[model samples]
Target: MIENQIGKRFAEALSDSITDDDRVEEARDNLRQFCNAMEQDSQLGRFFLHPSIPEENKAALVMEFCEKISALEEVRNLMRMLVERQKMCFVKNVSAYFDEVVARRLNQARVQVVSAQPLSEDHIKKLKTMLDRVLGKSALLETRVDESLLGGLKLSVGSLVADASIKNALALLKQSIEKEEVLSEFASG
Candidate 1:
């Protein structure tokens, strides 16, 4: 929880610093690349999290990385600030929250749709339109096939999930029947 708060604060600050939409996206990409590098290289990750290491050395390495990636100046400064504050361990969290911030800023909602079979292009378009209308924001749909659903679709938008699948309906029906059986037994007893 604390990590999310810290990351959200940093992400909002970074997001506010950029005025151009393109730069915001570029910074996001740069941050993602930097975070990926840190995660993939254990030695580099250790170096950043080492408390005994001097901040200057870490800041210098950060600058080198930013230059290599051609990161925006704002992004570079943010990285330097993280190093100075010894908050480099939260880079991944910050990156994740940054994406959410960007999506919110762009008035876009990412929706994950799972269905029993592949949807046609027309069906996808209709679904996207309906989502946009209902959500009051543009919908970015990521669709996939989940045959276990049997039929119907399951949609996930952020923390909310809407399950209209045959499997889910059957499970609910089963639960209802079991509850009714227990109630009938109590009445008879």
Candidate 2:
């Protein structure tokens, strides 16, 4: 497992170095995209994390990669530090935590919603507005369809899940009926 402190410190360093919101967001995007690439391509991750490759070569490769991605100086420095410490395998974890830091700075939450069917654009917009107001933060919604949902929506934001699906409602009703029947039986006996 990657150490959370390492990612936290790297994100803090990057956050401290950039003051402009646009530039900060750009840096975050650059890191996020590159880390996503690393995650999606195992060969890329292996190449970077391989012990046979010398640290200097790794540094050069990382610099070139960062330049290609137009990463800011702070991001480049963090990548170099990761290379030096031989922590390339933890790039995804670092990027994820870094994104959290950026999102927190922007007062936003990334929400995922699953429904029985695809929602209309207007419905999506209304849901976003409601979530934004209810969360007290800007909501970035990602939607998906699940046929098993029956109807309604399931929203996940951070650790909270709000399930309003007919499936869930039926399950609750069944449980309530079972509990009431048990209570009546106990009283009668």
Candidate 3:
């Protein structure tokens, strides 16, 4: 919970620093790229997380990385601040929340749709249209196939999940049956 707050604070700070929507997007991309590098390169990750490493070295490395990625000055400052505060571990969290903040700022909703099979373009378009109407804002739909769903789709918008999958339906049915059986036993007793 504290980590989430920390991540949100940093994300908001970065988001507030940039005035242009395009610059905000660029900063987000730069942050994602930096986080990806940290995740993909174990040595680099170690360098950031290592306690004994000098702060000067870490700051220098961050600056060098920002230059390589053509990061915005705001983004560079964010990284430097994180390094100084020893919050390198929260980079991924910050990136994730940064996306959320940006989406909110742009009056967009990021919806994740998981289905048993790949959805056709027409289907996606229809779904997006429906979601846009329901959300009252443009929906940024991200679709993925998860065969375990059996059928139907699961829609995730931020913390809310609407599970219409066959697997979930089966689980709900089973729970209902169990509850009915328990109620029947009590009545008989």
Candidate 4:
């Protein structure tokens, strides 16, 4: 929704203003946290986003929050840019899409790993290193233990899947048999 509405435009504009890739993350994170808070709480959201609210007030509050983080100058600049452009309404989507762009630049991937058992720090570190090497980029991994997988792990990154779990193997076997049965019936007919 908001992603579709503002993602591309926000990404292009944000990328242009901010050159350092990490600053993109900082801007994105700050915008996201601020937007999320405002969205979840109606009174503040209305107060800040109301058309009647003066730009000075918005800029002051933005500076106050930005100061709390001890963040880079680029972050404050980005927030100031949003305030100046009157685009703070879309800050949430802007941050989400900006992070997506930043991730793309780093060639970073969000890998979801579901294993039959919880992974130890050693396992995660080893896996992270392996993914970075194999993928030729950084990896932001979210690992979870899904006992329903029966055994082994199932990894998914974007559209790619590396399913080594017992449950998936069994499902694959079942599908193969059903396909074979259908083929046999067609041949007989």
Q: What is the C-alpha RMSD of each candidate to the true structure, in Å?
A: 2.8, 1.9, 2.3, 3.5
- lDDT per prediction? 0.95, 0.88, 0.95, 0.80
Residue-level lDDT tens digits of model 4 in 1-189: 654576567666767778887676776677667777677887866666678889899889888878886656766777787787777777766677777777887688889999999999999999999999998889999899899999989999989999999999999999999999999999999
lDDT of predicted model 2: 0.88
Error of 3 at 119 (Å): 2.1
Instruction: Please tell me which model should have the higher TM-score, number 3 or number 4.
Output: 3
**Residue 138 CA displacement from its true place in model 3, Å:** 2.0
TM-score of 4: 0.73
Report the CA-based lDDT of candidate 1 relative to the real structure: 0.95
lDDT of 3 at 49: 91
* Ranking 2 against 4 by TM-score, winner: 2
User: What TM-score would every model get versus the actual structure?
Assistant: 0.80, 0.89, 0.85, 0.73
Tens digits of per-residue lDDT for model 1, 1-189: 989999999999999999998899899899999988987899999999988899999999999999999999999999999998899999988999998998989898989999999999999999999999999999989899999999999999999999999999999999999999999999999
Error of 2 at 157 (Å): 2.0
Ranking by TM-score: 2, 3, 1, 4
Cα lDDT of model 3 overall? Answer: 0.95
